[model samples]
Target: MKRRQTNTNFFDLTNLSGDIRGGAISFLVAVPLCLGIALASGAPLFAGIIAGLVGGLVVGLFSRSALSISGPEAGLIVVTLSAIETLGSFPAFLLATCIAGLMQIGLGFARAGMVSNFFPSSVIKGMLAGIGIILIIKQLPHLVGYDADAAEGLALFQPGGFNIIEQLRMSLGQFSGVAMLIALSSLAVFYLWGRLLFQQRAFVKNVPAALIVVLLGIFINELVRMVFPQLALRGNHLVQLPVPGSPQEFLQLFTMPDFSQWNNPLVYTSAVAIALVASLEALLSVEATDELDPLKRKTPANHELKAQGIGNIVSGLIGGIPLTSVIVRSSVSINAGARTRLAALVHGTLLLICVVTLPTLLNKIPWASLAAILLVTGYKLARIEVFKGVFAEGPAKFIPFAVTIIAILLTDLLTGIGIGMITGIVFILREHYQNTHRVRTEHANNITRIHVSLGDHVSFLSKAKLLKLLKNIPDNAVVEIDGTGSSYIDSDVIKAIENFGVAACQRNIQLVFLPARPAESPVYTLTELADNYRRNNSERGFRHDSQPHLHRQVNPTPI
Candidate 1:
C-alpha cells in the first residue's frame, strides 16, 4: 500500500523533460514581474532575484507541492515597503525578515498552519478581488505610458490631490503614443489568444500569452526605432536590470542583515507581521494551486510552512526580499504542464542566467507590456461575475465577501483581513447560537405542544437561549425535551434543562424527557467526558461507566 501510494507522488520525476520545459516557460512569466515587484517594493532589484532563486532552489527542494512556484510575491509589496520605512534601513528590515523566517519555522513545528481553515471562502474571494482592483488601478497609468506618480499612491489620490480620474484626464493630453500603441496591441494579442486558445486547445494554450506579448512589444519597439525614430520610447520606459561588469562586481551586490537591531521593539513587531502575512499567503496559494493541479495533490500546509521558513531564512541572510508561494507564477507553471518541483528549479536556474548573462536582452523589454499583462491578471481576480456568484449565495455569504473587499481597498492587506476575520467569526457564532436547538410550538387536540429537539452537540454557549425558551413556554402546556439526536451535551446545558423541568411543573406545565438518559450534572461535563475519552474512547473498551445521580427509572446514558 505504501509503495502504491508512493507511485502517485506528484513530484516523482518521471516526466523530467516536461517539467524542464514548464519551468522555462514559467521563468519567462517570472522575470518582468520580479523586476516590477522589486521596483514597487523599493527593494534593491537584485533582492527579488535572490528571493526567486532561494524560493525555487531551496523551497522547491523542501516543499512537497509539485507545481507551486515560490518567489517574491505581489501581495507582500505593501508590507515590505512599510517595514523598510519603519526600520529606517534595508539592513534592519533584513534582520526582521530573518526573524520572520524563524517564526514561520516555529509555526510549522507547532502545527499552526491549520489557521487557514478558519477563514470563510467568501472572505478569501473578496480579498483576492480587492487585490485585483488595486492592481488594475495601479497599472492603468503604466499601461497608458505614464509613470509620474509613485505606484502606491497612484490609485485614489496623489499627494497633490490629483486622483486617478485626474491623471487619466491629464494622460489624454500628454501620454506616450508609442507606449499606448504597444499596450493596446499587446492587450489585443492577449485577448485574441485568450478568446481563441486559452483552455480550448491543449498545445496552443500551454504557450504563455504573456511571453508572446513581451516578445511582440520588444519587436514593435525595435521596428519603430528603426523606421519611425521620432516615436521611440526610452529609459525607464523599459526594464532596467543592474548590469554587473564582472563576477567581483556581482559579489559586491549582496547586503547582510544588521543583527544589532534586535534591541528594537519595532523590529520584533515587523517580524511577527511578515511571518503572519507570508505564512497565510503561502498556505492560501498552496491550497489554490492544488485545486488547479490536474493531479489534485494536497500539499501539507505545515510542511510548506517549514520549507518557506527555511527559504526565507536563507533569502534574508543573502540579502533577498521576503518570499512566498506566488499564485501567478505557479498558475503559469501548471498551465505549461509542470509535473514536478523541477519546473520551479528550472525557472530559478533560468532567472539566475538572466541575471548573470542576459541583462542587456532583458533590459530591452517594455514596461507598458508588463503593465498590460498585470492589468489582465487583475481583471481575472476582480471580475463582475465573482460578485454575481457571491450575491447568488445570499447575504450571509455576500456580506463577508463585500466587507472583506471594501476593507482591503480602504486599508492595508493585514488590517483588511483582520476586519473580515472578526466579522466572519461573529456571523459564524451568531448562526451557531441561533441553530443550537429547534423549538417548535404546535397546537394538537386542544393542547399547546412545545417540542424541543436538540442538535447533535450542545455546549455552554447555548445556555441563554435554552433558558429563554423555558421561560416563554405557555402555562398548562405539554413540554417535551428530546435528546435522541444529541451525542454529547455540555454540563451547563444539562443543568439548565433539569432545573427548567423542575420549575416547569410549577407553572401547571407537564414536562418530560423523550426516552432520554440522565446524568449527574457535574460528572457529565465535556471536561470530564473529554478526560474519560482521552483515557479510553472506544466502545466496550472503557474500563468504567459514569455514575449519574438520577434514579434507576431514568438511568439514561449521557447521550
Candidate 2:
C-alpha cells in the first residue's frame, strides 16, 4: 500500500549513458512487435506505432512501474476486432477507445485496479496461454506468405487471430513455397541463436534475436528475388509501412474519431468491454513483469491503471489503437538491462523517428520474419514448461487452468475468463465445505456419540453441510455441536440449529451444542434447547459425565 517512494526526481538524467543503451535495446525489440500487433489488431500499421510512442512518452513519464512497457497487445485482438465489427467503423472504434481511457481513469480513482488480484493466477496464465496458442495458429498463413485475409489480422479468433480451418485450407492450396522456406529458416535461426548466444555473450543476449531474424528474412527474400524470381513474395507478404516521403505525406496517415457516433449504444458497449479487458490485461502484465524484475519492484496497480488510461487517451486522440502494459515488450526491456522507465520512452521515440524517416528500410522487413518472431513469442507463452508447472499444482489447480485455456480458444477472452472463474469457484467452495468443520461418530456401550466441531468464521456457506450432518444423527444418539473455536457464525446456520434442536425430540436424539463465549453467540441458545428437551424428558433415563457442558440433551424413546 505504500507509495513508490523515491528520493530522486523522476526525470533526473543521472544515468544518461545507461538509459540510452537500454532504451536502444528496447527499441530494437519494440519495432517488430508494434508492427505485428498492429497487423494482428486490424488497425492501421501507424496506429501501433503511435500507441508505442504515447505509451513511452506519456505513460512512461507517469507510470511508477519502472520496468513495464505499454502498447497495443495481442491479448486484446479479439476484443478490438469485435468492437470494430460491432461499431461498424474504425473511426467509431477510436471513440470507444477514448471512452475506455476515461473509464480506466475512473477505475484508477475508484481503486478498482485490485480486481486483477482476485483472478486466480492459473486463470491468468490460461488467458495468456490461450492467446499464445491462437497467436501461433493465426500467424501460420502469414508465415507461409499466404495473406488471404491480410487486412483482417493474424490472431486465430478475430481481429488479429481468426479463421483457423477455412484460412488454412485456402492458404495450403495457394501457398508460397518460397515464403515458407524463409519462415522455416528464420525459425531455425531463432532456435539456434538463443541457444548459442543467450547465455554465452552479454552483448549478443542484450541485442534482440528478432533483429537478426528480420535481417535474415530480408536478405533471404532479396536473394530469392535475384535467383528464383518465380518463387519471390511481394506486396503484403512483406510489411507495408507506407513510405511517406514527406512530412505532409506522413500527416495523411492519421485518422480522427467520429464524434457523431457518441450516441450509439454500441460505442459505449465497446468502451466498457475495452475498459474491463484492457485493465485486466494491463494489471496481469504488471504482475508478470514485476515478478521478472530482478530488484523485485512492485508496481502499484492503481498507478498502472492511471498511466495506461492517460496513454490510451493520448493514443486514441492521435489516431492510435487502445494500448495496455504488455509482457513481451516489458520483459525484453528488463532483459536488455533497463534500469528505469526511460528505456520505454526511448523505444516509443525511436518508433516515431523510424516510421517517419526510415519507412523504406522498415518496409523491407518481411512479414514472414515477423511471423517467425511472433511464432516464437507464442511458443514461449504456451511453453511445455508452463503446462508442466500447472499440472504439478495437481488436478484441483490444473482443471481450471486447462478448462480456461479450452474455453478461451472456443470463445472470446471475456467468456473464457468467466468459465475459468466459475470452475475455480467450484473448487474453492468444495474446499471451504470440507474444511468448515470436523465430524466424528463414536459408539461406546449402548450409547452413540456424534461430534461436530466448527472451524473459525463459519458462515452461511457452511450451513448446508452442517445441516446434513445434523440430519444423519442416529436415533437416541448424543450430538455435540461445538462452536467454541468459531469467532462468527451466520444467522442462517443459527436458525438451522434451532430448527434441528426442535426436531430432535421426535427423533429421540440427544443434542449437546457447546455455546461459544459471547453475549449472544449463535450457539448461546443451544443451552436453551438442551433445557427444553431436559424438562420434557425428565422422566427418561439418561447418562451424563462431569463436563458441565454448555448443551446436553437427553432423551430415551420419545413420549
Candidate 3:
C-alpha cells in the first residue's frame, strides 16, 4: 500500500509556482490599493507601498498562514488620518508605528490572540458587511471619473452638503465617455475572464483579468486624449508613481522616526491607537481568510500577531503605513488559485520590482479600473448570501449584524464593531440566564421537591438567580441538583450549592445530588472545586462504582 504523506512536501513546488502567479496578480492589485489607501489615510503615497512590501516579504515569510495577504487597509484610514493630524507630522507617526509593533509583539507573548474568538459570528459578519458598504460608497466617485482629495471628514453620502445622489446628478455633465467605456469594458473583461472559457482555456487562464482591465482602461484613456482632447479626463484621476532618478533618490524617500520625541504624549497615544486598530484589523482578516481557505487550514493566531508585529516594525522603519492582514488582497489570492505563502512573497517581490523599474508603466494605469475591482470586492463581501445566512441564524444574531452594519456607516468601524459586540454579548447573556434559571417544582412523598438544571456553562452572571433559588427553598423540602447535565459549574454556583446544602442539613431536610459522584460532591468547599467541572468529570470516570451515596449514621448530627 502506498504510504499517505504526512508532510506538505508535494505542494512545495506547486506552492512556489502558485505564489509567483498569485504574487504577480496581487502585486498588480496592490499597486493601486497601496496608493489609494495611503491617499485615503492622508499619508505620503510611498507609505502604502512600503507597508505592502513589508507585509508580503516580511510578514508572509514569518506568518503561519499560507495564503493571507498583508498591506495597508482601508479599515485603518480613520485611525491613520487621525494619528497623522494629532502627531503633527508623518515622522512622529512612524515613532508610534514602532511602538505599536512592540505592543503587538507583547500581545502575542501574552497569548491575546484568542480575543477574536470571543466575538460572535453575527457581529463579525456585520462588520464585514459594513466595510463593504463603505467601500462601495467611497469608490462611487472614482468609478464616475472624479477624484476627490483624500480626507476623513468627507462623508459617504454627503460631500459638503450635497448627498451622493446630488453629487452624481451634478457630475453627470462632467462624465468622460471614454472613462465610462473603460470602466464598463474593464468590468466586462473581468467577468468574462472568470467564466468557463478562462478555466479550461490554457492561454486564457494565464492572463490576469485585473491587469487586462487596467491596460484597456489606460489604452482607452490615451486614445480619448489623442482623438477627442476635450472629452479626456485629467491625469489626476490616474495612478501616479514617484520618479526616483537614482538609487540614492529611492533610499532618500524612506523617512526615519526621531527617537528623541518618543516620550511625547501624542506619540504614545498614537501608538496605542495604531496597536489597537492594527490588531483588530489583522485579527478580523485572519478570521475571514480562514473562512475562505479551501482546505480549512487554521492559522495560529498568536503566530500571526508576532508576524504582523515584525512586519509593522519593518514597515515603520522604512516610512510605511501600519500593515495588517488585508481581507481584500487575501481574498484575491484565494480566488487566484494561490496554494501557499509563496504567492504572498512573490507578490511583494513583484511590487518592489514594479516600483523600482517600471514606475512609468504603473503610473499609466487608470484609477477607474482599480475602483471597479474594489466595487466587485465590495459586492462580494456584502452579497445577499451573507444576509440570508445571518437571517436564518435567527433574530438574536441578525439584529446585531444589521445594527453593526448601520452603526459602522453612521459612526466608524471601531465604534460600530463595539456596538455590535455589546449587542451580541447582551443576547448571549440573556440566552444564558433563560437557559440556566429554570425551576421545576414537583411533589414527592408528601414533600415538595424542586429540581434545578444548570446550564452548560455557568458564569458569575448566573449567580444571582442561583442565589435567589437557594434562599427561597421552602423548609422541610427536598432539593435535587442534576449537575451531570451541566458541562460547567462556576465557583459562585458551587458556593451557593454548598451553603444551601448546609442549610438543608440544619433544617433536617434532604439535599440530594442526582447521579452523585465524588467529583460533583457539594460536601467540599467551593474553593476546592475545579473551575472546569468537565475536566474533573473526565478524569474521574462516570462509573456506577464512582457514585457516592449519603449514608445515615445512628444519632448522627447535622454538620
Of the candidates shown, which would achieve the greatest TM-score relative to the real structure?
3
For every candidate in turn, the CA RMSD to the true structure comes to 7.0, 5.8, 7.1
Model 2 alpha-carbon miss at residue 324, Å? 2.3
Scored against the true structure, residue 399 in model 2 reaches a CA lDDT of: 92
- Determine the C-alpha RMSD for candidate 2 after optimal superposition of all C-alphas: 5.8
165 Cα displacement, candidate 3 (Å): 5.1
Model 1, stretches more than 4 Å misplaced?
1-26, 36-42, 78-89, 148-163, 166-170, 195-206, 259-270, 291-296, 332-340, 440-446, 514-559
What lDDT would candidate 2 get against the real structure?
0.75
Worst 10 residues of 3 by lDDT: 1-10
Candidate rank order under TM-score: 3, 1, 2
Where does candidate 1 have its weakest 10-residue lDDT segment?
A: 540-549
Candidate 2 residue pairs that clash: 40-160, 154-160, 155-160, 155-161, 155-162, 156-161, 156-162, 157-161, 158-161
Q: Comparing 1 and 2 by TM-score, which wins?
A: 1
- lDDT tens string, model 2, 1-559? 3235531124336645455555665565566566656776778888877888888788888888877888887667778878888988889999999999999999999998787677777887787687678667878888777765443232345443456888888788878887898889888877776685555977665455666777888898889899988877788787666677677888987889999999999999999999988898888788767766766777889978988999888888888888998776775566546666777778778877888788777777777887776677677778899999999998878999999889878776667878998999898888888788886666778888877778787778988888877777788888877776777777678788778777776777766667553434544333454455466644442222224353354332210
TM-score of each: 0.81, 0.80, 0.82
Report model 2's TM-score to 2 decimal places.
0.80
* Model 3 collision count: 3
Model 3's TM-score against the true structure: 0.82
lDDT of 1 at 528: 46
